[model samples]
Target chain A: MEVALETNAVFVGIEYLAIFVWGLSGGLSAVRKRYDLFSILTCAWMTALGGGLVRDTLLGDLPPVGITDKGYILTCLASGLVVAVAHPEIMRLKWTMVAIDALGLGLFAVNGTAKALAFGSSGMTAVFLGMATALAGGLFRDLMVGEVPMIIRDKHLYAVPSLIGCILTVIVYKIVRAGTVGMQWEMALDVVIVAVVFVLRMVSVACNLTFPGAVDRGGGASS
Target chain B: MEVALETNAVFVGIEYLAIFVWGLSGGLSAVRKRYDLFSILTCAWMTALGGGLVRDTLLGDLPPVGITDKGYILTCLASGLVVAVAHPEIMRLKWTMVAIDALGLGLFAVNGTAKALAFGSSGMTAVFLGMATALAGGLFRDLMVGEVPMIIRDKHLYAVPSLIGCILTVIVYKIVRAGTVGMQWEMALDVVIVAVVFVLRMVSVACNLTFPGAVDRGGGASS
Candidate 1:
């Protein structure tokens, strides 16, 4: 029972950290656009909570924790406030922000999949839910500011790492659930998967890796 | 019980019609952007179902009808296909499309509020949910195309009528639920509210009505 409690606490802590980092990313986006404080906060809350909200809704989890938990809301607001007041300072830490954001992506991917599986979702559905939970926050922030979602447009590895992490998480979860492994093993594997995903994201960014764009249809084709 | 069944049928029909019309609007937007067939369908589905999905999630109505109901999906797909194959014809009927879209807004507004109330949401929350149900589809479509949502930027009325309709729906729903009026009366009043909202939207469009823009802070002030 104590082990279970510790596990829950650890996951909750990760969730809060992810929300704060994502909120900061959201605030930076709004500040870059020269929006007011209210809009900045709006972006922060939406970017931090939107993905989880969608995942929970899809998985039949009502009254999602993002809205119900005071900590989540306060953390999001604080992140937004920090960015609004000191954007230049935040901007100076560009690489640090990117690393934190990548870590948040991995955290969200694992957390979302675990929750979805706990809710009795199929492995396939849970993987998609996890990816959505990792990606939808940034998607919301971009959409609010009338920009094409960078997940699709940018030549960077965002969705790929999350997808890989989610798939691995689902595999490990199933293996553990089937009694092939202990709870501790599953937890350890989850951490490893998240770390690998983070590392993969960082490498992709460093190398500027990208998927091929649209195929040539011969109408002013760039390809 | 027979009356209740008939009322459900009526609302179901309205919901399907609203989905179809909104899907067409989405498809039109995609076509105007010269998007491919898949993207047109995506836009249609998002615009037709996005609002209801958000509303249902917020109201704790899990496994939202937009995903579970085959009729809704089929209607949205059919609308998209119709627009894709005959966009010129669809564009030629601009006024007809506008009228249908306005009527759809009213239908969605009433339907969303009714569902939220059924799910035990507060009256105030239901009003916002209803407005979201009416407006979120277009917001999704606009965002997909990287355009500012017309609900915020357009000169013509959109949200106002939806807001009025939702407020009226919530008031009438509460009044009827309090046992002061019958279900039939509530249904009748709902139709009246929808009609009023439709008329209000059309009048606003005809008159080119607009709300005041953001307060000018003298930074290249247009006001």
Candidate 2:
């Protein structure tokens, strides 16, 4: 939680960018589902902020950062409004949306874990919180749209890369003894984890990589 | 949070009953949707425990009581397993499930408000959290099962009665000066609110009561 104060100024740009991209996807998803405007706003906010809300709450931080920050709320709403007005055009740029989403996912996963560690969470709890921060919004959106959550059902490797990012974050914290480390190191580690998550997610998508265990073997399985 | 300890012994009976009933409905919902058994357990936990988890997290309580208490988890899973294996027989007792669900809804709404007040939250916030604790799980379950959430889209008044109960609970706290009040008054208030919710929910179902505002006017101007 304290780390947020230091990162707030430097990373404000990326944060808003991530929020906008995530919120846009959320709005587009709701529009595609034929949900009304109010529902579109809900989807947009969920996609942009739900993960952070869950992470903060799990960390025993009430009045989640996402809710308390006016800028965060406005940025998410702006993205939703943009999508609502320009959905047809946005839909045409599908790959662009995917790339932006991947970027948001990585940044969120890294920051979420680091924040949890700053709040004194154990390594495993921090990892879980990080992944939740990255993936919960999409799961929420998928459910809201009456679809099975892609994270659990689709072999997209969405959670896998997020997990790796979160783990790397914890490892960096462990090596540097987070509290004693310099802010620059913490920020640098954040960049590294985000890059790792972004690259892994993009590569997995491009190469169509997935966990073998998730595939259905059909009725011929020996079991 | 402290109130839970004092009320735990006296209310433990009703708590388990609510958990069992909610869990059963969750499992039944998943079974009806032809979801896998693991998904059935997920539905059951979400229906029986998700509300509490959200409430606790929002209140800045770490390790939600629902998760910390082994009995709670087991009860939810047990109910899910029971329904998964015996759904046809369980579905036959449709009225029974309704009665039990109404009971669970009442208990959760009342206790959720009381718990929030005990945690030193404001009156309105307590009311909001109470309604959330009662209704969120069902909303989560409905979403998971690929249905328009009954609370938001359906005319069943699922949340209306729960809201009334939660508001009544906060009012009771205001009149009683919660922290200064004895366990007896607290317990008495819980029973009264639960009774009100149960009666209202059942009567609404029986007499088909619903908010006139929620009714869609369709294309016609008037009737």
Candidate 3:
């Protein structure tokens, strides 16, 4: 029982850290849009919470953790507050934000996969859900700000990396279940997978990788 | 058999129109962000398809129509093409975009409710799904662009209006089934509900009657 509690604690802690980083990125983005402080905080909170909300709702949960848990909301609020207070200094260190954002992505990808598996979702569904959970928040942030989501178009490998990490996590879980490894080994596997994805994403951005040219098919598309 | 075919045609036609308008808004928004044409098209497609994708996936459907249907993809592509060509001129007439957006919202709200019912969802869940379908695309667009989602922070009554329209549609369907109303009356009810929502949205926008004020539960209060 204690072990289970500890595991839950570890996962929740990592999730909150990821949420903070995502909130920071969202706050900084809103600053670029010249939104007032209220709007900035609102955007930050939404970016931090939106993905988890969608995941939980789809999984038949209510009042998603991001909204129900004081800790999650507080973490986002604190992140936004700190960024708002230190905007000038933080804005100057663009690389710091990017690094944190990448780390958050890695953490979220792993966390989402683990969570889905814990909920008894199949491997394929777990992987897809993980990728969705990691990317959805950023997608929401971009849309709210009236910008195109980088994940869908840019070949910077954001979603791809998340997918890779999630697949690795699932494989590790299966192998460990076969008695080939232990809990510590599983943790190591997760770390390595996340690290690989983080490094790959950084390199992709550095190399300015992008999607291929467009094919124009004509007409008015509506949702 | 002819009646069923006619129903299918009407539903498909309205669905395509809804996708077109939603996609157009997304494409135009991407253009405003100065994204490349490929990125614009991607955003357009996501905005057009995102809500339906969510709705279908939650309903346990496979290979969502937005992904599997060539017609849907073509519609998105066409919307992007038109937006790319006409954006400069259209940028000046924000009201036109707003009107079309409202129309799309209403149509999708009704369509989403109908689809949810067809999928055997409960009335409450159907209404929720309907509002989600109507608003999710725009919400996704705003988030992708790093803007505050209009549904959350803006006082435009966007989601609320959709909810009302959806409920009205559901009630009409129920009445028709109870023999208190005919099929034509049910269809007319849908049109009336949509029109009411659309007009309400336009009036709200023009009057600038946004949500009253910020609720300060925690964090620093905004001015």
On residues A182-208, what C-alpha lDDT tens digit does candidate 3 reach at each position?
A: 766877677787788888778768888
Worst 10 residues of 3 chain A by lDDT: A214-223
> Which candidate number would show the highest DockQ if scored against the true structure?
1
lDDT of each residue in A73-192, candidate 1, tens digit only: 789989888877767766778898899889889988988888788878899998999998999988988888888888988788899999999999989988987899887787788889
Q: Give one digit per residue, the lDDT tens place, for model 2 in B1-223.
A: 4554235675678789789989988887776655556567768988998899889877877857655567888899899888776676676788888888898888899888888998899989999999889988988888777777778886666798899998988887776664677655766876878888998888888888887773576856555
Report the error of model 3 at residue A211, Å: 3.7
The CAPRI quality class of candidate 1 comes to incorrect
Candidate 3 chain B lowest-lDDT run of ten: B1-10
lDDT of 2 by residue, A76-174 (tens): 899888998999999999888778788888888888888888878777668768887998888888877877776646555677788899899888888
In order, the interface RMSDs are: 6.7, 7.9, 8.5
Interface RMSD of 3: 8.5
lDDT of 3: 0.74
* lDDT tens digits, residue span B57-102, model 3: 6676543555556788789989888787776555566787788778
* Worst window of 10 by summed lDDT in candidate 2 chain B: B1-10
Off by over 4 Å in 3: A1-15, A152-155, A177-184, A213-223, B1-115, B118-223
Error of 1 at B135 (Å): 3.7
True contacts kept of each: 0.19, 0.17, 0.14
What does TM-score give for chain A of every model?
A: 0.92, 0.90, 0.85
Clashing pairs in 2: none
lDDT of 1 by residue, B1-223 (tens): 2212126676668667778888998999999999999999999999999998878777676678679879889999999999999999988998887888898899888888777777777776677678878988888899888787776456677787888999999889888879998867877888898899999999888888754332333332221
